[model samples]
Target: MAYVGAATALGLFAPRAWAQEGAPAAAGAVDGDPKAFGPERHGLSAFGELQYPADFPHFDYVNPAAPKGGTFSQVPPNRSLNQSFTTFNTLNAYILKGDGAQGMDLVFDTLMARADDEPDALYGLIAKSVAVSGDGLAYRFRLRPEARFHDGSRLTADDVKWSLETLKARGHPLIAQSIHDLERVDIESEDVVTLRLSPKRTRDLPLTLAALPIFSKAYYSAKPFDASTLEPPLGSGPYKVGRFEQGRFIEFERVADYWAKDLAVNVGRSNFDRQRFEFFRDRDVGFEAFKARAYLFREEFTSRTWATGYDFPGVRENKVVRETLPDLTPSGGQGWFFNLRRKKFQDPKIREALNLAFDFEWMNRNLMFGAYKRTVSVFQGAPEMMAMGAAQGPELALLEPFRDKLPDSVFGEPPVPPVSDGSGQDRNLLRQAQRLLREAGYAPKDGRAVNAAGEPLTIEFLEFDPGLDPHVSKFIAGLKIIGVEASIRMVDAAQYQQRMNAFDYDVVSQRMSMSSTPGEGLRQVYSSESAAVQGSQNLSGIAYPAVDAMVEAILSAKSREELNVACRALDRVLRSLNFWVPAWYKDSHTLAYWDAFSHPAQKPRYTRGAPEFWWWDAEKADKAGVKA
Candidate 1:
């Protein structure tokens, strides 16, 4: 999906794959001078040099010769509620009023495209080239003369400027907040546009602007931009809106005269002639549909379903293929996030006790079929960014100033979630949790935890996915054993988003995807300024000054080494806060699909391109008895 900003609360995809085919520019073109902005280039990376040069042919991960003529239909990934859509009321994915259709991002093209292979790199898409000022305050983009909207109108700087202003003023809360530091968009000419940034901004600000999806200002001139409507807006992407049944299904047809069909960044992508999204209310029903060939591809999320539910006839007959694709990117934060706004959860001892009470070992073995690993840090699975062993070296030096404000553990080995015996009830850990609770001014009264006010401790685990009940209920049962009254409250996707946006619940299940090159997005999650902003990504209600300082250090980092040090320091501080009950993550993507689709021998390390890069095979479909 097209994420609004860096710290996507829900439906966010990983950084786009990097292009590795082209060589870097000559030494004189650009070097280690932070004050010297280079001439217009095809791409920009956050910290270091771009991997692909101006004349690159195509991304290394795609098959430039891959055929593209068949339809590819499938369910969206099950990472977030925003990803799995039941119905859609609006074609506008940027607004907050209604659930937008999945894959709507396919209809609009951004000024620049991200490279999946690199940590933070963006190649020009709508714009032919981009240049940043020497002082890092102004960014100029030259629009491609050949670029045009789906309606055949020539794209210009006016459209780009209009998009920035409109989205900043009238878009969703997240979108507005993302561009809050964007001072203004200036139209230098018919083809060149310049963006002026506020003094308080990061180097990635220009790159973030590159990823902004542009819209035709003329279309919204006659239509309501903020309203949730089924009307498809005008776009310049490779795919145009085709047929749809409102919330049931939506199809996108490849544009024969797509302006950037042969761009270096898109040569092997948009392979499917017609791509469609089929929605199901429940995941089990969707699985059955996959078994019956209703959809051509499925990415399994449930471990039990993946382990035991794949023994069906399609697989036995060799008509279906199940493979695990390794994920090389950071496994972002996923956990039970506590609302620190609540007075009851403000105590550090209580937060630590709650983290200790949950038994991930038992849940993973019994419920997940032993198919998961415990998440250790915000940058879990990312070696360079994750803080390990202890805070030392540059990481320690960064934390030294905040020593008085942070826990002593920040200076020691980073805190990890408590590990328990696989027996479900680890009495030893429970005893330790009880001791912490007692120290936090909570005492066991009549076999229940009660505060100094004589009120019993109660926790409401707010969940949106019904499939999560089995897992959440187990956690709730564990809390009960620790003299805490905890119950699971299940709600639909809409209600869940509404409550989460308002910060109405005690605790909620949240999954936040992290970028390899972390930037301003960290502020939305860890900065004190975002804690009270409705719909902000600060799900844990974190307002610690230490975290805010770390975020600033990360944003202001000039070199890759500096960025890594700052990110590790931030990871250590956040881990030490114990704001979340860490969840589990798989290192690979489990995919099951009919044997009718073919992709390049190599997959991008950062993304599963799916229908974007995979082409359909008529002969394989015929042999497998699968209908397209």
Candidate 2:
């Protein structure tokens, strides 16, 4: 979960990934600045290559002529900030309080918008153009004169300045940590905003800043910016909060006169007339709701449901369509993260032993129907950033200084999760885990291990719902085999958020992916500073000088190649440390929805271009007996 501005990467959420497809710029890195900020650039990219020029029409991935006016509803694909998969209790998605409602990103606009077809390139959305300083620490954004909020008030540079200040001061800790290096925001004019960064800011800080959500100074001035509230905040995006309940469902109405609808950056996007998000405390219950058309769409996350649960009447009558779309973004990071804040999990050996106890090979076969591959790297699906074999060339050079701090295995071979013998209870692996526990000064007896002080090494697997009960129950049995006292704690969505913010759990599940152009966002999840922040995403409480140094290398990288090298070096060190029991991943998204929607021929390469690019098919909707 990376709202560290990821609501598809800004406004209310934090940065996640900025990847796309485009040929590299032939002019080379403009100003030798990684983002190609040379002379009133209308677009920005990590490697200075931008396929879409200033005068370009709509994005290649969109259908400019797509008809709008349809209802696209589903469960939230992924969540960040205070969002919950099962339930939500607040419309305030940016703060660290109640369970935030999904689809809040639709309510606000950013200074710039991402071109989904080009990796890491952001074209002007609300901003007309942007210019960067020679030192790459200052950015001047020229906002569109016509940009106006829902209440028809002109969105000025003043709003941008106030939003940034408020987010830094009272937003979620993740947002605060990601933008810690932002020095100041200077409003040059009503339509112009200048941002000054610290000299030590990350290379991608400019991009992250551009993608941040702009909030109305007037709307927030009359209300508390940090507390959760059911009242929707004012927004300037293509959609506005229409009708919503506290926790059950929320809907966003497309702005009939959306100021930027015809803009090149927004053409053929946000096609849904009404986008709705539904809540179900359980995955099985949600599936049943989809069958009954309680919601019109779903992106299936459970492998067993995809494999065997689609024999309902809707599927039999051809009213529902099921297909797999390729997920091109980096697998990012997904696993059961260990809370290193706890002393018992501070030992790397014990962490590794805990990781070894899970039989991924067996889980893939029996539980997941062999639909996923073991996620081995934090940059799991991204080849450029995944560390394989031994580090070499600039990657090795980057790690050379931290050799003494990192394990020797990081220098020899990248750590890989142990392959089980396909047995859920692999005795050999269990024995290996037991031996590691003993070496770590733990005594194993009676299916439980204790430290030298006789304190039982117990781990509470924390979760908000029973969606993972089958998987965790099996994993806990494996932990018992190795004398680790593991138990699962199922809490409500509200309690889960509170405990996560307080860092009170021994272990919790988290899934975060990276943008093609990774930068400051990584710091929110791995930097030592974030580890100390209460509501930050550094779930493992990673606070190491070596890791900090690696994060710095990533942030300061001057080229895509340099960034990849830094990521691999960091990945090597993280794997050796075993902060998580790496989970499984699939590169394709399994989708099942009613036959009431149609989409453009080409889908955005980086984002899950669903409701954003999908239009209503009146004929199909009639056949499916659904309301459009």
Candidate 3:
């Protein structure tokens, strides 16, 4: 609920420069003067002031005195850019051409690093400090004097400039689309870099630029930056690529002489001497591997496995431990997203029917063992952004301008997905769906639904894993009962990614994690521009002008209160559009790991700082007879 004061309400990241204290004497330049420069600030946040000040020794979420030395291995619980949870074929993780490996970012350093304890605050990592221009269009970063790559080469501001330009031109479609507003990167010297943004840039662009991975300009000069390759690129981070089998596993060895290891931002983190990720195409197989000690940690995503599969020998003997840590991050949009580009899914009326057809109550009780709650909003986990009973005050005013272009529900009580009568086959809901389908010009002809033009109303639910077949089958069954033809089409993970990038699937299930301090990421997920980008995350292909306008409102919000109002307005609009059949989300991370490790007293508010901040518990490993 904190709001930035009027003096700092420029919609720009607050200024912070590392190790630097006071500002130079000013010539009395006013606030709006383009020549005016802010004081050196050690960190930046989306809005308001930073959580940690410049002189803080280490993050409060970390145990700064904790010892380092251990091996932590697990399957990747989350992925970004081009990473795949199943397998990786390329070491180049920032492009769109390959199934990129997880943890590659561990080897690369960004100008600034996130304080996982805070919503969107970032502290200096490679850059010792950061400062912003008065007009809010430029950000200057001063590189740390000791910053060095794995090869002991001094990392420079020129490298940062090259990275910005290269990524904008050849990075993944999502990355490219997100950073398209970066006008230019000006290298003031080998240590200072200035990034100038376009006037049309989003409010969070400075943070985005600061968080971009710093690539070694020399290492990539000989190698093509756009190709898929197995060679590990040079980086100046805490870890470097260590051992790997192309498709099975990849390990990162902790850099003994890493330049920034003792920096406040990294203290007591990346504790393991070695970090590894084991790849598996199936969840059940991955679980079996965990039982065999193939991986030391597992963050369970399937509710059924959490309910029944944990009664193994390891659990009974206390060799394995489970932690139900609360996930305080936003569980944004998790659902079966309809590809709005598809002709059949263009009608909101039809999409609503599909949404109403999902029997979440019955599924949660029987199949999921009553593990989850039915999710309703695109901004489900972020309460600040979730639309409640009705729009009023700021939300209503912000949305009133687009009233004619939006559904009537935007002005009324938000539409909640129909509550299904716990009979897996809810006849009342099915009948209601049938009515909507009929109104949309689809009706039963010879026992199967078809449009007036005689086009059959069929939907293919695309999926990569067979474990979800049971879930998909039940939904298809409900659709069949309502006279619609629906079936599941299985594909491998790589194929699935390719199909998704090409927007070839009819409907696919996905979960999008949003920042508690939401900003520019909205464009990459819901904007009209992203809808046309091949590999962008706009899975639903949403391109409505109203949606784009709502996204702009969010970006332009100067305070936390304004941001909340904007997000709720967006949530109202997105829910009204019915672009997805909303799914379920649990606010807790169901973590099952070997009892061979121990962690800090507190977990980061925004991240599950497991294996990373966790050092090996020597006595626990010995007592439990588990492999470290």
Candidate 4:
């Protein structure tokens, strides 16, 4: 209840669906000096010398002039972009813990970024500098004098106050739940905005405050918040929404007379003349269009088309340029999800058995065409990933208390014992599965698993969106080998959402995109309270106490050590639960683009997924004869 209450206070009313998520370009050969593209690049003109802060970490960077007009096509999910009034909270970007539906962050601006890697931090945007009170209850934001919204209205303390107060009152329950104390937004003068909160809410204030998306009171007051109408969404950033077509694409035009055009933070970005997003319903169709030169670039792989079906002579002659970026992007977890709400899968043993039945080695090589990497824990191959510390000595000490809550072997070395295949077609894993099912009150008869009272144990592999339908179908074939009767039923986007919200799924396959913060991720995935709630991210429908405690501790952790300790404990408990069947990770990005484009020699790190940091070179683009 404490978890739910706090989440509500911060306007986090609903679990976020999957959404478009970015990459940076490495400073390579350019027409200008490489250092010219540092964070300070935008603040200086073409002739000015580059500047860097003393404390700023050195990053592989690039700087290019805003390229001429060109259109970038992307595949968008079928969902309503306008969520403010459609049973979804629009103002709760920060409080919601998952990758939200489309257009949340793209349309709005947050007070601060979730991490330092991304540029959303308002160092020179709206707030010049920020200071947190010693007790953490009070936060002071020093507003930049030149900050103004798209409508040319100067951003003031009232706008910030109104945005926060309005969200606290009318925002989602999750948003308002975390924020307590009816403290006032004290205007400490024209340039200073001080937010004072009660002591009870200061514990996790930074995480919550980091989510606040300060809106212009002037723009919103003129017209009510309505999803049906795409009135120019007010923003204090360098880009503003110019045009939007329902279920299509939204175009953002640069603010020509923008206040922060020369701001230090605004430099080196918004370099495109017009950022136009083209939406496609399917990825394959989009890829074909990319091959036909309809779009700027496409992430291609050695699938049926790339391996054998490249009939286009031009593309064949000038083969798609391939490059490998080393250890820069976050290799996200992509796999099938076991919905624990189904009584058939409520037993952890059954879930574990399902995980052991398939071989990732064969699947990646044959089915996936060697495009994926095997993942053990949810956070695999990530730096300081929780899985890295699972059975490590000191990390085990943190998890020792939950030995009873988890499998005994989990706290000991090697975590959960690996399941072995039984010999003679009745492998050790099959025997173990039979044992576990019997313990869960299942009986086997005539090569079929039956539940209590002679009902055949049937599990349906559900797919709502057709985007993942084929992959789900391929997985169901694997399940059949293990004597599980599995099938796929693809629903349209609307129906898929309805069924998902009702918790009407058996074994659903989904790719859960994670954030940089493990605390935020742990809450969304394994919390007991979140498991039961409709639209909750705990899609597994698991309710475990030890996992819950670790999640809370991780959320409230102050330093890196506390975070590491809590993460290891939570990982052990979650793996023992076995609610999720480990799947594959996309190791390499298979992008195919027209010959007209030249990319940066060095690839920028992708803390986010991919796409945000890619820039267009008008010179190379024109030389290649590509058009908008």
lDDT of 3: 0.81
Using Cα atoms with residue i matched to residue i, what is each candidate's TM-score against the true structure?
0.94, 0.94, 0.95, 0.79
Residue-by-residue lDDT tens digits, candidate 1, 214-261: 999898888888887888789999998889887688898999899999
Span of 10 residues, lowest total lDDT, candidate 3: 1-10
lDDT of all predictions: 0.79, 0.81, 0.81, 0.51
| Per-model C-alpha RMSD | 3.7, 3.5, 5.1, 9.5
Root-mean-square deviation of candidate 3: 5.1
TM-score of model number 1: 0.94
- Summed over model 4, clashes come to 27
Kindly list the per-residue Cα lDDT of model 4 for residues 488-580, writing each as its tens digit.
776654455456656788866555544334433445456776676555556677677777877776655554466556666666666667777
lDDT of 4: 0.51
Candidate 2, residue 197: the lDDT equals 80
Better of 3 and 4 by TM-score: 3
In each prediction, how many residue pairs overlap at the backbone (N, C-alpha, C within less than 3 A)? 8, 17, 8, 27
Error of 1 at 148 (Å): 0.9
